[model samples]
Target chain A: MCNERQEQDPGKFRDQIRQGKWQKSTSGACPGYVQANLVILPREFALDFTIFCLRNPQPCPIIEILDPGNPIVQEAAPDADIRTDIPKYCIFKDSKLVEERTEITNLWRDDLVTYLIGCSYTFEEALVRGGVPVKNYLQQKDPGVYISSVMCRSAGVFWGPMVVTMRPIPGHLVARTVQITSRFPKAHGAPVHIGNGEPIGITHLEKVDFGEPPVIDRGDVPVFWGCGVTPQLAAMKSKVPFMITHKPCHMFITDIKIEEMAIS
Target chain B: MCNERQEQDPGKFRDQIRQGKWQKSTSGACPGYVQANLVILPREFALDFTIFCLRNPQPCPIIEILDPGNPIVQEAAPDADIRTDIPKYCIFKDSKLVEERTEITNLWRDDLVTYLIGCSYTFEEALVRGGVPVKNYLQQKDPGVYISSVMCRSAGVFWGPMVVTMRPIPGHLVARTVQITSRFPKAHGAPVHIGNGEPIGITHLEKVDFGEPPVIDRGDVPVFWGCGVTPQLAAMKSKVPFMITHKPCHMFITDIKIEEMAIS
Candidate 1:
């Protein structure tokens, strides 16, 4: 009943995650299937967070959202369990990571709301398919992420700067890369800032705020795309005492294709 | 302070609505302007509504969403006031129409969240421009609407059959019409049902749940697109004590161009 058997196939991944055998990062599971960035917050903060995502769509293109207190991601995965399906979980208490568990069966509450934001990995697949060279995409490394100075439109108790992931596309193919990824608005569609890293207030390229340091060649242009770190940062700023997120790289893979999210 | 300029201009129409003038239905205010469907609910119901929109995107493509209790719609109109800007408003109490006002200034609440969903008017303009004759578009009549038995995906307390708007396309131009309208995801994107009316559980063509009767022809095929009414229908079903929406034929016009909504 482990997720290992379900790894290659998304349908079986649902079964394995349901059976509690797949307590592993879903990074390599279901290669073509869309993996979602999850954030489950209580009712008290649900409205502000939903507004936050709707306002700042680039960093938070919501793939699917579940009803308040509903464990089943009805649209993303009809029978999938949000509390136990995510391979790993990050629980935050008033902006602090208080626990890291394999499942949130004990933490489930009646007013909790789940948001499944689109991951950049979905578009990373597009950049490769468009014939652009994505180094981290090929090596299976998380793109370098940073807490940028780009502020998100605030909603009620939620407010934070836009978190962006850095990927160095060469100057020649930068336009092509942009054209390709622009089609997937749900997956951080296009590059927010193209060239100047310092303008977005990135002090240093070599030192990343999150993920591994990106590779930059002589002609490589450092392109930044919105990251899943956005809602994480927003939740931390609001300091919602009861908030849970998927562990980095440990996502909730849905039974949807990446192209299904491409502006459709 | 009347909307004195060209009726087809969005900016001019918005300018008039903002200055405490032109508070009538926005149906004929701006001919080609993309009118939006408004939904204002308390924070308690926002996450569920947002989830409902995400699940049923065809019926609810979002234009811009304002934060809970926030009066400003920054992206759609940075200086626009949500409470007084729209021409007409409908107040709902326990799913019943309690009041119809020009402004909600007296009802301004700290817990209210505003959502602006895309309207069919965006694509109706595209269709008209493409030489596909839209009788309603020319006659200044309301687009035909109906509440079909086809159930929309539910979220929390929101659940109901989708309300669809019918457009009769000549047999030969049906495919072309679909291709053109398909470009605007912000405007409901594409048709869900075509050719047959009863399959989606519609019994009569003229006895619509809302709006005018379609002018179906001998060589025409009835095409159905998800209407913003679906969300309102869902909200009414929730029986929430308090909810606010735009009056029939009344909508909020955005500064964004209709062409800007077209997908490449």
Candidate 2:
């Protein structure tokens, strides 16, 4: 119920949201824990989407995948229900946003498969700790997301352009930022492109596609990382019959500590 | 084909196998290229097997997964056919080894799905390059394999104990060995257990389960790594109706270089 208590325990934080006691974006809560983007699809399309994630790991680094129709997460957060843990959920039908709900307990079905994907929060924290400038982090808002010209490998029915989140890093820190962020491959790993937006088809950095235009400092270089919003675009472009995702900025907090994701 | 020729071109090596001019194990051939363990299954069991690999990446690090019934590998090796590229293939029926064939073109099915998993050879090369002693490299044979008590996270109809390959490292070099091998996550990453193997259910270091017994010198400590042979064990234990895998020591050589698998 309190900020201090939620920061200390991922379980307690989920319980607060599950019971409807707290319903807000989980951006800064549970600081050290891993936060994931949720994607729920029917078993019919699970294989294609799973393969899609496997092929496009930079954009879709999967943290944990629950069994079909199973809502309880065992690895990331033990006993956390995928249906009610997040503050908000977006229901998509025929490639369109059909509903927004706080909880989907009534909509849970046996054939629905839940996939917890790594988001940028984990690596962005590492970047900030590594002395890199993250303008969106300082402003406490989401970064600018763009649909790049790079197309993801098609798997069965899932295919779309990769979506990336841009962060302005000083020219001197671009290499260091890549080193820091590359440690967490599960959290969208390293930058897919750096400095030049023209090659990746971003003609204008300020002409935003999804989020607000980023604030680029005088001597900073723009670094782009694969974004979790990619699946949403894939879903819409493919016109999937039914799908569910966590609303923007509201993520599923897992019990895995950010340190556990770092490689040697 | 000469040894020097095969070492330079992975595509030429596969062409030799396709032409039946070479039918030997792929060990020490194509030094810098990546070699993968092959697993082919029916589409009915592909999802479960794919989930099994995703859940247990330490033992089953997948390098590339092909589209269902499509044998041409696009990412790992362009224009390479999975059926005839490998030197040998093992056919399993109801958990029993039914045949060992040079190619599976006759047995290829439209519903079959192929999974190319990371083998320890990639990391072993790095270890040798980093000045670590590798007994199997000197002996020109596969390392000792054991079935451990640690069970893999099961998915659907697939479940089995983890299989690990044992390497004897001198006490002074164990830490360095971990560091060197941990860089290549695609190649079974790092050692699962070091020093004594009793905790992981390996009582006798000499009693081998799958391969030749290792050579442990004085002051040497047994280090265990997740082996690619794990999927074969799972297939046998789960009594999968029909499955295909590359024979022991014989592997599918991919075009990806060893350095590409390294992480920061």
Top candidate when judged by lDDT against the true structure: 2
Top DockQ: which candidate number? 2
The 10 consecutive residues of candidate 1 chain A with the worst lDDT sum are A1-10
Q: Candidate 2: which docking quality band? A: medium
Q: DockQ for each candidate?
A: 0.61, 0.70
Q: In order, what lDDT does every prediction score?
A: 0.83, 0.89
For model 2, residues B1-264, the per-residue Cα lDDT tens digits are 126556458998899888887788888888888999999998888888888988999999989889898999989999999999999999999999999999999999999999999998888888888999898876787899999999999988889999999999989999999999888889999899998899999999889998888998999999999999888788788888999999977899999999987876
List, residue by residue over A48-112, the lDDT tens digit for candidate 1.
78878877888998887777777886766677888878878999998999999988898899988
Per-prediction TM-score: 0.90, 0.97
Residue A246 lDDT in candidate 1 = 94
In the range A104-196, model 2's lDDT, one tens digit per residue, is: 999999999999999998887788878987888867777888999999998988999999989889999999999998889999998999988
- Best candidate, TM-score: 2
